[model samples]
Structure formats: C-alpha cells, structure tokens
Target: MPEPVTLRPRGGMIIAAIALVIAAAALVFIAIDGGLLDLARWAWPVVLLGWGAWLLYLRPYVRVSEGFVEISNLVRTYRVPWGDIDSVDSRFALTIRTRGGRVIRAWAAPAPGARQALSTQRADVTHTPGDDDTRRPSDAEGTASGDAAGLVRRELERHRREGTAAVGQTALTWHPLLIAGTTALAAAAVVSLVLPHG
Candidate 1:
C-alpha cells in the first residue's frame, strides 16, 4: 500500500482563527466609531452572532486513506469506506454518495500539495479509460471538450474508481452572502454604538 495520504484543507486552523479575530476586531472598531449601529439597526449584532456560530460549528477537514475517507467539521466527524462510495460528484459542492444512497457534501477539494500526493498514488491503480486516472490529453481536442461540468464529472469518477481526488486550495471563498451578511452586522453594531441616547 502507498504511504497514507492525508489531505488537509489549506491554511492552518490558526489562520482561520486569526481571520475570525480580525473580523471581530473590525466589528469592535466599527461599534466604537458608531459605524456599525448606523449601517443597520440589527445587522452588526447578527453578523457577529453568525460568524461566531460558523466558527463554532464548522469543522473543516478531509482525510482520505487507502481504506476510507474521513471528514470532520467543528461539529461532527464521518468515516466511510472506499467501497461504500457509490459515486462522487462536484457541482457547487463536492459530494460523495454511498451505496446506501446517502450523500455527503464538502465545501471544496483538498489543497494542492495534498492533491499532488494523491496523484502520485494513482500510478499504481488500474484506471479505466473513463476512469478519473486518465489524464486529459494535452492535445487541442481534449482541451475543447474539457468544460467545467466534464471536469467535475471526471474528477468525481476518478476518485470513486481510483480512490483519490484533487483538493482545492484554501482561500477566502468570496461568497457574496457571507460578505453581505458580515458587512450588515458590522454596520449595525457601529450604528448602535454611535447614536446619541438620553
């Protein structure tokens, strides 16, 4: 068996904690400056509350071994055998379907270094033509058909068959909802702090 492949989400937990801290600090600054409370009556408090909730609830780790896949968030952990996986698919999220038909979705793939390590393991597996192991032909024709959906399908199939898949790098997702929500909350806190009250 190949060396155990461990794929962790990019960025140490420390970074995420730090980011939360920075965001919290910014909220504090906004509140003291009377900006948050002014932005919206209840927004800032809500944002802070949500942020805290996510930080407390979101456990973000994905680990794949020769025998099984392990996923954990701040709240729970799941372990599934490779053979139990029915299919893998990637859309807005990456999902693993089990023979029982239950689906587990991950926010994104593992990091680059982790992916590279997994790719190295692929060399030993008997990869079907349509299997994920088949690398895209470097020629133009392959590129033409290599659309996003195709890539996602290919990746899912690859991991399902060969027991490996690429992991996405860790970075700010830039999700609009999260950004807007955070902004709203921060603004509300500031406004509340600033308005004069008798």
Candidate 2:
C-alpha cells in the first residue's frame, strides 16, 4: 500500500489566526489592567474571530489514501472510496464527483485569485492532469486546488492501473465541535455586545 498523502494545515492561516489571538489577548490585558470588564466584553468578537479564522482556514484538508479520499471541508467531511469516485475536478475548488452524482468540494484547496490566474500561462500548465485545451485556473500548477486535484487524480489512476477493485460507499459527516464552538462563540459575541457589562 502506498503511503497516504494529506494536505494539512496551511501555515499562512495558522499565522493569521495567531495574530488575531494576540490582538484579542492584548484587549483582554487592557481590560484587566483598567478593571474594565466592559472592555473585555468588546474583545469577545475578536477572540471569536481568531477562532473563526482557524476554523475556516486551518481545519479543512484533503487526504488521499490507497483506498479512499477524505475531504475535510469547513463544517462537513466526506470519505469517498475509490470505487465511488467518478472524477476529481478543480473548477472553483478541488471537487470529487461520485458515481452516484454527488459532488463534494474541499475547502482547503481553492482556486487561485485573479492575479494568480492571470499570471499562469500556457507554459505553466504543461504537466497538469486535465485537458490542456480547456483548463480552468484551478487546474494551474501552483494553485492549491490544482495541486490537490493532481494528487487525487494520480492516486485514482494508480488504482485503475493496479486493478485494485476497491469497494465502499461515500460517507458524509458534520464537524460537531466546529459547529458547537462557532455557535457558542457567536452567541457569546452577541451577548457581549448587548448585555450590560459592569
């Protein structure tokens, strides 16, 4: 069995979240030093925003194992077996189309921005997996979605080449902790804004 490949945490996202957290901590310190809990209340959104940054950017990933592709999106995750996948696409993001016609997008791998797309020339896309005659910017070499889709496509092709008749169903699941935390933090932020903090 080939080793599984995972596109895990994005360093840029992690650094940005850390910066937000630091800013929130500074606000909290000011509130403590001044004995002003009201000021602390104003920091709720900042703290939540820090957590939100991590939730949206750092939490998502795409993992390609010998038998399956796991897509950990923002609030939901999907484990689609090789047998279930019809194709891997990178139109707007890295997406998996199942034999049953369900399409799953991976939030971790998104298309390049307009500037990046404009910079990608025909010379750069020579080795990309899809049709060269008609390729989206998402299929460009340096883009996140393009790279991830390449890995997924290669793995799928290898499965076909090896005659590995893998069998399984596609499973969908929600990120319970993410959902709960976001709800709790959003509520806290709202309360901090409306409730009288003395």
Candidate 3:
C-alpha cells in the first residue's frame, strides 16, 4: 500500500499560529495591566482569535489511507471508505460525496482563488501527457484544487479498479478538546460578567 496522504493548508496554519501568538500576547498584556477584570472585558476578541486558531491550526485535516479517508473539519471527524466515495469536489473546499449520498467537506483544504486555479491549470497543460507527475497535487498548500481533486479522484478510481473496497463504516467523531475548550472559555466569560468586581 502507498503511504498515507495528508492534506492541509500550509499558509493558513502559519498565519493562524502568528495570530494566536499575537492574541495570547494581548491577553497577557491586558491581564497584567488591569488585572482579570480588564482582561475579561476584552475576552470576546481573544476568544474569537482562539476559534480562528482552532479552525486553521488545530482542526481541518484530511488523511487518505489505503483503506479509508479520514476528514477532521473543525468539530467532527468523518471516516469514509474509498468504495463509498462517489466523487471529490473542490468548488469551494474539498468536499466528498459518498455513494450513500452523504456529503463531507474538508475544512483543511480550502479552495484556491481564480488566479491560482488558472496557473495550476496552465501547469497541468505544460506537463507532458505521457510523463507522470511525481508530486501529489494539493489544493490548500500552494497546489491547485483541480490537481488535488484530480489526484484524489484517480486514487478512488484506482482503488475501485483493484477491488480494494473494504467494509468500513462511515463514522463521525467529535473533538472533545475543542468542545471542552469552548465550554471553558464560555464559562470564564460568564463568570467574569456575573461576579462582582473584587
């Protein structure tokens, strides 16, 4: 079997990390300057930054293995077998349509802009028809969605041709860490608002 393929947005992750650092610094500054009360007042913006970090850095990944494709898009992880995937679409993001008529979107691989998409198409045409491209085409990480989508579609086709369909159940798993973090943030915000200043 080939090595597992992981698809994620390279640029977004870096940007998110930078933003997270900046937000954390601001949080620390606020807490230090005026205590918890001042920090609490501006917590909403910090919370928004955290959510952005969660979306860009923590969540949204696609792992395509020989057996199945595991997609974690923010809150839930979807596991779908190769046989169940009808098609992989890249209209906005990487979306998978299952033979069972279920649609799953991958948050990690965002669709490229029009200019980037065009350049990718040009790149595809420039390659010799007979010469195979060694690199796995990706949409979110500087690679175009068209190439990434085509690669995935071809993989699915190859799996079908080889009769490699296994009995895999389509499952969705929630991210407990994300849920707990959100809950904690909300609780802190509420406590800050409700309790009188000491």
Pick by TM-score: which candidate is best? 2
- Against the correct fold, how does model 3 do in TM-score? 0.73
Please give the lDDT score at residue 144 for candidate 1: 16
Candidate 3 to native Cα RMSD, angstroms = 4.8
Per-model C-alpha RMSD: 11.6, 2.4, 4.8
- Candidate 2 structure quality by residue, lDDT tens digits, 38-71: 5656777777777777777787889888889999
Per-residue lDDT of candidate 1, residues 112-175 (tens digit): 2434334433332223233454433211112211222233344445566785643432222234
lDDT of every model, 2 decimals: 0.47, 0.81, 0.70
What lDDT does model 1 reach? 0.47
Minimum summed lDDT over a 10-residue window in model 2 is located at 8-17
**Candidates sorted by TM-score, descending order?**
2, 3, 1
Per-candidate TM equals 0.39, 0.87, 0.73
| Residues 7-27 of candidate 3: C-alpha lDDT, one tens digit per residue | 777766787888888888989
Model 1 residue 64 lDDT? 56
Runs in model 3 deviating more than 4 A are: 35-48, 118-141, 190-198
Error of 2 at 4 (Å): 2.2
